[model samples]
Structure formats: C-alpha cells, structure tokens
Target: MTLDLPLIWAGLIAFAVLAYVVLDGFDLGVGILFPLVQGEANKDEMMNSVAPVWDGNETWLVLGGGGLFAVFPLAYSIIMPALYAPIIIMLLALVFRGVAFEFRWKTRRGQFLWDWAFAFGSTVAAFAQGVALGALVQGIKVEGRAYAGGWWDWLTTFSLFTGAALVVGYALLGATWLILKTEDHVQRRAYTIAFWAAPLTLAMIGVVSLWTPFLHPLYVARWFGWPNILLAIPVPLLVLAAAYILLKGLTERRETSPFLAALSLFVLSFIGIGISFYPNIVPHSVTIWDAAAPDNSLSFLLVGAVVLVPLILGYTGYSYWVFRGKVKAVGGYH
Candidate 1:
C-alpha cells in the first residue's frame, strides 16, 4: 500500500508527539507528586527514580516540535501564534523544573527552595501544556496562516477545564510509575495515590468526552453517526478496561501493571482524539494535505528522518533499560 507524503509525515509527527507525552509525563507527574509525599526521604527517592532519564525523555518533545515545523510548516505557523503565550510559559516552567532537579541536591542550605521550585515548576508546566492542548481542541483562531485572535484568545473556559484534567492525569501516571520504581512505604503511598487518581482521571475523561462533541459538528457527527459509533466504541472500551486494570493493579500491589495500564489509557485517549480529528493536522483549520510542504522537500527530509529518528529511539530505549531498578533514597544523586 502506497501512502501520500503528507499522510506519512503527519502520522510520523503525531506518533512523535504521543511518544513525548507518555515518556515525559510520568517524570513530570513524579515532580508534581513530590509535595503530596509525606517525608523528605520518600520525596528524594521519587525524584531519584526519574533523575537518570528525565533529560533523555525530553528529547522527544524537541523532535516532535521540530518535525512539525519541518513537515507541516503551515500548521506550525498558525499554531505558534495562537499558542505563543502558553508555550512560552510552558518552556520557562520546564527550565525551572530542570534547574531545580539539578540544584535541589547541590545546596546544603537551599534544598528547601529548590524542592519547591521543582514541584511548582512541574505543576505549572504540565498545566500550561494542557492549556495548549485545550486551545487546540477548543479551536484556535486562524486566517491565512496566521492566528486571527487576541493574546487572551486561548484562555477559554474549556481550555482551563482541559488543563485541570491533565494535572490529574499526570498525577495518575506519576503514582503508577512510583509503584513500579519503589518499594515499602513509598510504593504503598504511590499505590494509594494511583487508585484515587485513576477515578479522577476517568471522571475528567468522561466529562471531556461528553463535552467535546458539542464543540464541533465534525466530531459531533463523526462520533454519533452509526458506523463511526460502532467503530469508535473500541477506543472508550479499551480506555475503561485500562482504567480498571490500573486501579486493580494498585489494589493488588502488582508492580508493573499500574504503569502499563496508565500508558494504555493515554494511548487510547490519543487514539480517540486522532480519530475525531482525522484529516485535520490542526482541527477546523489546516489539513495534512493543505499544510504539507512540497513533495520534494518532504522526500528529502524523510531520508534524514529515517536515519535520525531510529537512533534517537534506540538511545531512549537503552537509557530506560540501563536505569531499570528501584531507586535508593540516598538523598538523590547530587
């Protein structure tokens, strides 16, 4: 089966973005979960669990952003202006989180300050990312490759709602990750958090799913029409099943199942959105075909991409493999 260049590029960038979200999400979740942890020792262990690979996990975000810019310049042009505010905030927050991760263990007297910085920065960064997602799904203002809206146009109620949902979702990922990466009191605490967080995540999913159809006729029709309904049923069904497994794993103290289940839930959410927004690279605006660069440009880019992307993936997998183990709470690697 042959494929259109634009379709191939769109799918590639979409997969890259999904990889970034799932990969970076749990570490950020761990950061956000820090304050909720009762003791300094537990928090240190939680931080240590992510310390080895946090920077590597973030590489996918850069790849995703660069791929979008190269493959779909038109969509990139429109999205940046619409989301510049939140994007800037998100970047700044990430910087804070990254810096805090390094500095928190470096200082003898300033650990308190750095710890707060890490937690706050992670929370804010995650929230801003959700805001950006919300703005995308809630519809951005675009006209002829430009954002045709004011600076505050992205600050819609629906966007805020999405942002809140993402916080809970990331917390769920973080807790599940802890279940896989720690033991004893820390593990139990993470398990308890996962159990509660999953239900909250589900409630948000339910609300977002029900509310989203009303936002656009394309999705409304696609989701409710007969064949689409039958075909689309699997996405939600899988999501629910994953949610059940996640909670059950936490309850039963199954170490890896919670993390794996959370990953499945995230994948299903992305799939649902992908299906609902088919043909649209940016919903209600640019399409894959319309936003794609010239065929020759894409072909040339694909040659380099074919080589570079796999190397990045191999390193990512290897880093995870090398770091695979329960974290020790020796006050983190300073």
Candidate 2:
C-alpha cells in the first residue's frame, strides 16, 4: 500500500502529542498534587516517585513542537501568535519548575519557597495548556492569517472550565501513578485520591463532551451525524469503562491495575478527541492539509524520524526498565 505522506506526518504528530500527554501527564499530575501533600516526608516520596522518568517524559513534547514546525509550519505560525501570552507564561513556568526541582534539594533554608514555586509553576503550566486547548476547540478569532482577538479573548468561560478540568485530570493521573510507584502510606493516600479524582475527571469529560457541540455547531453535527457518530461513541464508552475499572481496582487493592486503567482512559479520551477533530489541526480555522508543509519538507522530516523516533523509544524504554519498582524513601537524591 502506498503511503499518504501528509496523513502519515499528521499521525506522527498526533502520536507525539499523545505520548507527551501520557508521559508528562503523570509528572505534571504529581506537580499538581504537590500542594495537597501533608508533610515533608510525603512530599519527598512523591517527588522521588517521578524523579527518574520525569525529564525523559518531556521528550515527547519537544517532538510534538518540532514535528509541527517541520510538517505544519502554517499551524505553528497561527497558533503561536494567537497563543503568544499563554505560551510565554508556559515557558516561564517550565523554567521556574526546572529551577525549583534542582534548588529545592540544594538548600535547607527557603525550602518552603521552592516548594511553592514548583507547585505554582506546575499549576500555571497545566492551566495554560488547558486554556489553549479550550481556545482551540472553541475556535480562535482568525482573519486571513492573523489573530484578530483581544488578549483577554482567550480567557473565556469555556477556557476556564477546561483549565479546571485539566487540573482534575492531571490530579487523577498523578494519583494512579503514585499508586503504582509508591508503597504503604503514600500508596494508600494515592489510592484514596484516585477514587475521588477519577469520578471528578469523568464528570469533567461529560461536561466537555456536551459543551463542545453547543460551543461549535459544526462539531455538534460532526458528532451527531450518521457515520462519524458510530466511530466516536465507542471511544468515550471505553473510557468510561476504563474509569470504572480503575475505581474498582483501587478498591480491591490492585495497585498496578489503576495505573493501567487510568492510562487506558487517557488514551481513549485522546483518541476520541482526535476522531472528533480529524483533519482539523486548529479546529475550524485550519485543516491539516491546508496547514501542512510542502511534500518535500515532510519527506525531509520523515527521514529524520526514521532515526530519531526509534532512538527516543529505546531510551524511554531503557529508563523505565532501569527504574522499575516501588519508590523508597532514600535519604537523599541518588
């Protein structure tokens, strides 16, 4: 079978985004959950749970951005300008997080300051991305190739809802990750959190699913229409089932099952969104084909992916393998 290079690139970009969501999602969830940690010891255990794999989890984000720049320059140009403020804030938050991660360990004094910074940064970054997702879904105010909306235009009720939903979603991911990576008290707390967070996330998904159609009539038609409806419904139903299993696993003291089930729900929900917005990179503003780069640029990127993607996969696998097992309260960073 011959390849459709544009679709192939689109798939690669989508895969990169999904990988980031799963990998970085847990760590960001950890960050969001930081403030709720009861004591220094618990916080240390929480941080350690993600320390080994957190850095590598960001690799998929780089791939997502780079892939877009290489294969969909038009979308990049449009999105970046429209999201300039949020993007700037996100970058700054990430920088703050990186610094806090290193410095939080180095100093005995000002430890609380660093902890707050880390948590704040994580919340900011997560919310900013959520707002961007909401704006994209709600459709950006575009005229020709430029963004014509006010700065506050991005901060709508829908965006705020998305922001809160993402925080809940990330918290759920973090809870399940902790369930998998920690033991004893930490694990118990995580399981409790998961039991609560999972249902909240499910409720958020339901709200977003219902709201999206009313927010965008086109999306409403797309979802309610004949053939597409058949494909779209199953993904959400599967996600709901996964969430149910996650809750059941937590209650049964099946530690590993919650993480797997949580991951499955995330993947299914992501796939549902992808299906809902097939061929549209920036919702109504830009179709994938219109936003995609020339075939020559795609071919060049494809050649690089041939080497880079496999190397990334190998490294990610190796890191996880090396760090596999429950987190222990080692005295210091190793």
Candidate 3:
C-alpha cells in the first residue's frame, strides 16, 4: 500500500482545527455573552461553567498550528504572511481573554474593567477568526510560492459579514452550553438566546451559501455543475435538521440535547466547507499537493503525530469528563 502523505497530513490538521472550533467556540460564546448578563452572580456562574476546561480547549489550536507548519511548510509560509495582522490580533485577544479570566477574581477594585476586557476580547477573537475564514474563502493572492496580496487585503466586505455571522454562531453555541451547565435565570436567558440566535445563524449561513460560489468559478462548477449538485443535497438537509432539533431542545428546556444539537450544526458546517474546498488547503491559490512538505519529513512527523495526537485527545476527553455537570455560584472564582 502507498502512503499518501498529503492526504494524511490534511486529515490530521483538519481534525485539530475542527476540534478547536467546536470546543473553544462555546467558551468564547460565554465570553461574548458577558455584556448581556446583568447580575454578577449569573456572570460568576457562567465563568465557573467553563473555567475548568477553556484552557484545555485551546490546546487543539496550538496543535493545529504546529501540524500545519510541520506538514505543509509552504502553505504556512504563504498563509502566515498573508494573514499576519488578523492572526496577531486574534492571538492577542485570546491572551487578553485568558488574563481577564485569571485576574478578574484577584482585583475587586478593577473587576469591572477585567469583565469588559474578557467580553471584548472574546468578541474580537471570534470576529477575527471569522475574518480569517472569510478571507481564505474569498481567496488569497499567491505568486510563485509567495504572498501577492497587500496587508489590508484580508478585510473585505464579505470577510466583515462573515465575522459578524461568527459572533452569532458562537453566541448560539455559548447559549446551548449555558443551558446544559446552568439553572434558573441564567438558563432561561440562555434558552431565549438560543431560540432567537437560531434564525440569525441560519440567515448568515444562507447568505454565505449564496455569496460563496461567486468568489470563484471552481466552486460554482464543482458544487452546482452536472451531477455534483445532486451529491451536495445532504449538507443542507443535515443542517436544517440539526437547527430544527436545536430549536426544539431549547424550547423544551432539555439540558444535553441543545448542546449536542448545536454541536451537530458546527460539525456539519465544517463538513460542508470540506466539500467546497477539498484538495485546496489554501483555497484557490495553493492546494494540499502544491504546498505539501517532503515525504520524508511527513513520515518522521507521523511517528510523533500518531502518538501525540491520541494523547492530546485522551487528555481533553478526560478533562471534560472530570468537570461534567451543573455550575453553581460558589461565591468566588474557585
């Protein structure tokens, strides 16, 4: 049997990225919801709900970045330069969010400022990630294995729209998580957000669906042309089904179902993205094959990856398992 290095690395990195989005996404959602939460008690409950696991959730992002650099150095070289600013902004925002989470408890005098920092940081980070996604989807400029676009080219109209939509999406995810982890007023608020956020999320997805094909002829030709159109039916159907279930779960106040249903939407959305941009790791400009590292390096990396990836997964799973249940306001940040 032949070893397909590019395909293997793509799958590995894609898994890491998806894991980060789904796990860290909900916690970021919690942070984004901070401004809307009125009571300090409720806010502490929200923070407690995710405090144990948010740090672990971010580990996948680091793994994804490292995997990309090791397995596809050229893609990393081109993409890092093209998206230098937003990437830095996203990282700094995450740092600020983390710091706020830590220091908000220690300093009572400046607690209000820290709370705002956490909420603002979360919103900015999520928006920056959405901008990154939109920029890639809109396509990057690559010339002779180098970045061809200007520094500000990443901020197009579509990218901005995508950023706003991600805020909604992350908000929905956060709401569902609160439903599972909180009770009383906080949980009710979460239920309400989940109910209203459903439509806005779907609408954003709808607009992106309409706008994405026009970005490149390949997307139009691949997804809507000939028999490929027929094959793409399940994606939308699954998304609609998940959304319906999410709405139903929220309405009924089911604890676990809402979170599971929301996760389904994210997973399916990623699957849709994979279908749209398969083989192309960097959208139109660079492909998995075009930017893939040498076979020997991939082989060496695989040895560490095969062992390291599973350990990370196991640790992450164990952490969640350890912290599973409702979050009560324990008076202070324990």
Candidate 4:
C-alpha cells in the first residue's frame, strides 16, 4: 500500500505543536505570574526553575512551523498571511522574553526593566498565540488558495475572549509549575493563584467549547451531529475529570499532581480541537491533501524528520531529567 504522507506529516506536526504547548507553556506562565509575585528572590527562583530547559522547549515550535512550511506549503501560505499580525507579535514578544532571561541577571540597576519586559513579553506572546488560534478556528477567509479576508478580520470579540482565556490558562500552568518547582512563600503563593486560576480556566474552557461550534456550520456538524458527537463526548468528560484532579491536588497540597492535571486539561482541549479539525488543515478552507506539498518532497522530508524528531525528543528528555527536582533559593542553573 502507498504511504499516506500528508496524514503522517499532519500527525507529526500536531505532535510537535502539542509538545511545544505543554513544555514551553509553563515557562511562559511563570513569566505571566511575575507581576503577582513580589520579592527579587522569589522572582529569581521562578526564573531559575525554568531557565535550564526553557529555550530547548521551543524546539518543537520550530519543528512544527518548519514541517508545515515544507510538508504543507499551501496551508502555510494561507495561514501566514491570515495570521501575520499576531504571529509577528508573538515572535517579537518571544525575543524580548528571551532577552530578559539573560539580561535580567547581568544588570542590577536596570533589572526591573528586564523583569517588566519578561512579563510583558510572555503575556503578549501567550495572548497573540491564543488570538491566532481563535482566528484560525473561527475560520480564515480563503479564496482561490489565498487569504481573502481583510487585515482586521482576525480582531473579533471571540478572539479577544480566547486571548484572555489563554492568559488565565497560562497563569494556571505557571502557578502549578511553581508549586512543583519552588518552596515556602513562592509555593504558597502559587497554591493561592492556582485556586483562583483553575476555576477561571475551566469556565473559560466551557465558554470557548460552547462558542466554537457557532462560528462555522462544519464545527456544529462535527461536534453536535450523530456519530461525531459520540467521539466528541469524551473530550469534555476527560476535561471535567482533569479539572477535578487539578482542584483535588491543589486542595490536598500535592505539588506534582496539580501540574500534571493542568497539563491534562490542555491535552484534552487540544484533542477536542483535533477532532473538530480533522481532514482540514485550515479548518473549512483547506484539506490536508489539497494543501500538501508533492509526495516526493514529503517522502524525502519524512526521512529527515524521522531521524531529527527522535533526536530532539531524546535530548529534550535528557535535559529535563538532568534539571529535575526543586529549584534551590540561592545559586541556580540560570
């Protein structure tokens, strides 16, 4: 039987995106929590907790984007133009956030500026990412293989709500991460933050779940229609289960479980999205087959991806393993 290159590539890209979200998300969440956390030492501990692995966590993002460009050029072409504004903002924010990571250590007098930059960059990056996701889910207007929507088409109430929702979601991730990686006051504050953020994140997830189906008829059919609904039912059930674990972990004062549960919620939500967008790389506008590059190109790229992806995974796992355990309050990996 012939290989289904497009489908394989789609799965690979999806996995990469999920890896990036789960791995890098907590660090970004930490940055978002920077404002709420006081004391230079507390912030230092927060930064130190993620410092060793934060940059490496972004490798999946590069892989996902590059895989899309090489394996699904049509989708990239359409999506880039459609999301140029938000994508650009996300990139800039990431640059600033990255700079803050290093420079914040170098300067004593200007350290506050870097702190603000880190927080601002992380928040904006997270928000832009969510906005881009919302705009895509809401549907990009594609005509004749090109984006036909106006420049401002992405700016909508739904998109704004999703952006805000992501901020809270990231904050939850950050708080849970802090609970896992810090001690004393930082851990206590994280517990307090998680208590509030967990409920808000769940409510936002519920709202977004309800609001998404109305954006397009295809989504309604995929989510609410017959056999598809059977598949769809488990997503929310799993989300509810995850939410319970998250709350229980927080209340019971378990450090690791809350973080794992928060990650599970994101995973469930992602799977729900995948269920909605199966077959269509650009939602209603483009199918995986229609948007894919030539088969020969895919086959060639697959060989490289097969080798590189595993190596990436191996090193990523090793880095985390090496850095595992609570971040000490004093000298650290940063």
Query: What's the TM-score of each model vs. the native?
Result: 0.96, 0.95, 0.97, 0.99
* Of candidates 4 and 3, the better by TM-score: 4
Q: 49, model 4: CA deviation in Å?
A: 0.2
Q: Rank the candidates by TM-score, best first.
A: 4, 3, 1, 2
Q: Write model 1 residue lDDT over 1-334, tens digit each, in one string.
A: 5559999888888888899899899999998888888787887899899998999889889988998899899899889988999899999999999999889878869888888999998899899999999889978777767779888988999899988898899999999899888887888888888878999999999999998998989898778887889889889889888988887887788999889999898889998888888888788877889999999999999999899889999998998888787887884432
Candidate with top TM-score is 4
Query: What is candidate 4's CA lDDT for residue 211?
Result: 96
Clashing pairs in 4: none
Q: Which model, 3 or 4, shows the larger lDDT?
A: 4
What C-alpha lDDT does candidate 1 achieve relative to the native structure?
0.88
lDDT of each: 0.88, 0.84, 0.90, 0.94
Instruction: Indicate the residue-level lDDT of 310 in model 4.
Output: 96
Write the number of the candidate with greater lDDT, choosing between 1 and 4. Answer: 4
lDDT of 2 by residue, 1-334 (tens): 7667888988988999999888888888888888887888888888888888888988998999988888988888877777777778877987887788889888878888888888888888888888878877888777786666777777789988988888788888899999888887888888888888988888998898888888777787678888888877788778778987888998898978888888897798788778767778877777888888888888888999989999999999998988888887674333
Instruction: Provide the lowest-lDDT 10-residue window in model 2.
Output: 325-334
| Candidate 2 deviant stretches above 4 angstroms | 331-334
